[model samples]
Target: MSNLSSIYIHVPFCTKICSYCDFCKVLYDEKWLRKYLTSLEKEINLRYKSNKIKTIYIGGGTPSCFDNAFFEQLLKIVATFNKGKDIEYTIEFNPEDINENKIKLLKKYGVNRISIGIQTFNKTLLAILNRNSDYEDIKKKIKLLKDNNINNINIDLMYAISNQCLSDLKDDLEKIISLDIRHISTYSLILEKGTVLYNKKMPLISEETDAKMYNTIVNFLKTHGFCHYEISNFAKKGYESKHNLTYWNNNEYYGFGPGASGYINNVRYTNTRNLNKYFNGNYFFDKEILTKKDVMNYEIILGLRKIKGINVKDFYAKYKVNIFDEYNIEPLIKDKSLIFEKDNIYINPDKLYIMNEILIKLI
Candidate 1:
């Protein structure tokens, strides 16, 4: 194995912090921006192993917010990697952060994919999440990217916002479908402990309503020519997120920058989210080497997230134990919570909402 086919770099600076975000982030500062990119270059030089990389994803605290000079420098550092002819290089952008100049820069540097943070189209819901993009802004930005011939795009959406209703959700979906993008990732809001929304005690709608809305979105997207291939993602044919698929398939990759995580050589580790610690060259919090059982458990938990599920033959080939014998799945299948077909074991569509409970029993 070459050990470095995929890479993810986290850029932790944002122009405006969203109320619901708990990810490692800080408000953008020019001095810190220069220092952070320097440190990022150092970290990449030290840890990145394989020169031939295929899939690269630059995620954020709003990566697209970097000023043009710093943004070019950041791209220059990654360009050192030996890239394939058609590497799936992606960068996360905010809807308002992109313009003609940035679009040109991205295309010039071979960034083939763009993921936008357009959480919702409703005004009140947008304000509640502290997001600032509007319909016109997003539509224009999408056109800008496509006009530059960077057609691979993904947009993020959120539901279960404070005071959100089923009708509001359906309307959002209709607008999103009309955009004709390649990928969409929709998540239900979770009130993380330290976020502004959680501190303010923003209302999380009823579980019944949440369930209904989730089901509605799934059906709506399916009806609109999107494949609900993963739990929280849909895509047109041949446009699935290859970088994320690396994680779901349990493949190894590099995670760089503050608050990053990486798995290599059967060991999983998370870098420190502490900025000062990372700047001081202290990145890892700890590392855990997986035992056989631990690896199998991870395989099941992550693989089951996809619609195709886990292949039994591959499982036995990897672990030398039939999953049927290692863990009791027959009962789940019998009860209609899971299905075994085409030599793969998958969660039933109706039971996907309760996937956690079923996974608990499997583990």
Candidate 2:
């Protein structure tokens, strides 16, 4: 087995499920959370041999929703993993659940980064999305985080909601940026199957409007010194998300808990999604032992998400094969959808909106 430099712990309990979330999660219950955490510990010990983790990301239905004691215990178990002196530990928080006590616990556990799920400050949109926070609550939480020295914060924003206008999106962005936070992740609303929104037949913004909003976000963030490092992520210089970069860069990582997925030694595996099955000791949702072709294709798909794109020399070195010959991407290159320069291959900026179509041609 290869060494894992990154680890992801999924805590699948939320106080309430958002309308658009299809992630594996359940409503908060003390008994269920205890059982899940016990199983999660076992899963971690079973899969990982070393604790030398450079980065640890605690994500979930809402990690901060857990009780302070439970959160402390989880962090103590995580401490068993190989965490270096410079480990970048992050925990995702919902504004409704974040408090002074929770913030202190995060600091005590060596958490250096925090991602707040402040999708929007608009009360109407918050209600529609089933989010349990208001602008005032979020502002107070931000102050708490800052007071506790948790300055490495990232805020999530969503656009393209039904009836959402460009002006509304601009207001949200301005509010988030005005917080002086170093990073932001903005996503266009997608009505994924199996989510509450989809089941309720909720409407979404028109494709044309969504595209315009996305372009507006890119331009606006860039003007404010936030670099569009990934498709949906923007960050101030030197503040890019290191944990997520591990995934986009195609590095080996370990994932533990329900519905968590990981890639190691060219094999990708997902843990069981069923909480009962997981607690009963049945894990490993689905696994794929990828071939060389599978790896190459994945490299292309994931790498293209980054604006910096794939390094041609590094790709060739990793596979001991020429990328040009393997994918036959010259047609895309000729059409200006793909560009090859400086030993790197990337999609053209203008074609990023149509990345799927371009990737289909390459694959």
Candidate 3:
């Protein structure tokens, strides 16, 4: 068995659902939350084995929506794992849910990182997207986090809304840079099926316009000392998210609770997305045991999502196979869609928009 060292817990309840979000979440209710926590504790205990966990990420449906008692109980359960050595612990919070009390509770529980959902600064656009926060609220929460000495803060931003002009995006970037946050994750709006935005036929920016906006954000962040570590994530010199890096690097991780997925020891598993099923102790999620070929293809697909792309040396060290020899990458290299240099391989700058196509060819 592979040594498992990373854990991800998903809390599937939110105070309000965003129109554009397709994540598994439900309208929050106190009674439902209490029952959910009870079930969550049982799930954790059921999955707990003597594995050395190096990182723990409490992602959500807005984990910060939980009250102090629930948060404390959840942390107490997680504390059963290793701590105080070199572990990185993170919790995702919605901007409106953050407060002085919550920040204090997080610090008490040894949470070293906070990922805040601040989709946009424009109040009008936020309303259009049905996101629940104003600029003032976001600012206050960010200041509170900083005042509480929460150093590693990750801010989430979005672009390509129906009426979002380039200037609006610039203003959002300005507000974000003004905070001097350690990390930022920016994503283009995707109208997933079943989302309110998709149902309403919200307009997405044209391909050219979206590309320009993306490139602009990248250049601006780089000029401000934030490294574009991944396609959607920018971080200062050493503030890269270790928990997320485990996923990008294809390392083993265990996921618990509802709607959480994990890749451990080359086997990919997903916990049940249905909250009721999980609460019923079904653990009815799917699993895909990856073969050697599956792993090699997945490494290429996932690694290309990073701005620095894949390190051929590290790939060979882990899999004992040269990546180029394992796949037909020559056509892409000749077409200027892929680049190989300094023992690393990455997608060409201009062709990053078509990375999926290039990866499809490789696979």
TM-score of each: 0.98, 0.97, 0.96
Could you tell me the lDDT of residue 138 within candidate 1?
79
Extract clashing residue pairs from model 3. Answer: none
**Against the unseen true structure, what C-alpha lDDT does each candidate score?**
0.89, 0.87, 0.85
Question: Following a full C-alpha superposition, what root-mean-square deviation does model 2 have from the true structure?
Answer: 1.3
- State the lDDT at 323 in candidate 1: 97
Per TM-score, the best of the predicted structures is 1
Tens-digit lDDT track of model 1 for 52-75:
788999998889998888889989
- The deviation in Å at residue 81 for candidate 3 is 1.7
Q: Note the residue pairs that clash in candidate 1.
A: none
Tens digits of per-residue lDDT, candidate 3, 1-363, equal 354778999888888888998887888888878877888778878776768777899988988888888878878888888653878899998887787778778888889899988889888998988886677777777788888888799999999887898999999999899888899999899999999989999888898888888988988999999998887899999999888888887778888888889887788988888877888998748999999989888888888888788998999998999888998988888988899889878999777777778888988
Report the error of model 3 at residue 181, Å.
0.3
Point to the candidate with the largest lDDT. Answer: 1
Q: Which residue ranges in model 3 land beyond 4 Å of their true spot?
A: 1-3
Rank candidates, TM-score, best first: 1, 2, 3
Of candidates 3 and 1, the better by lDDT: 1
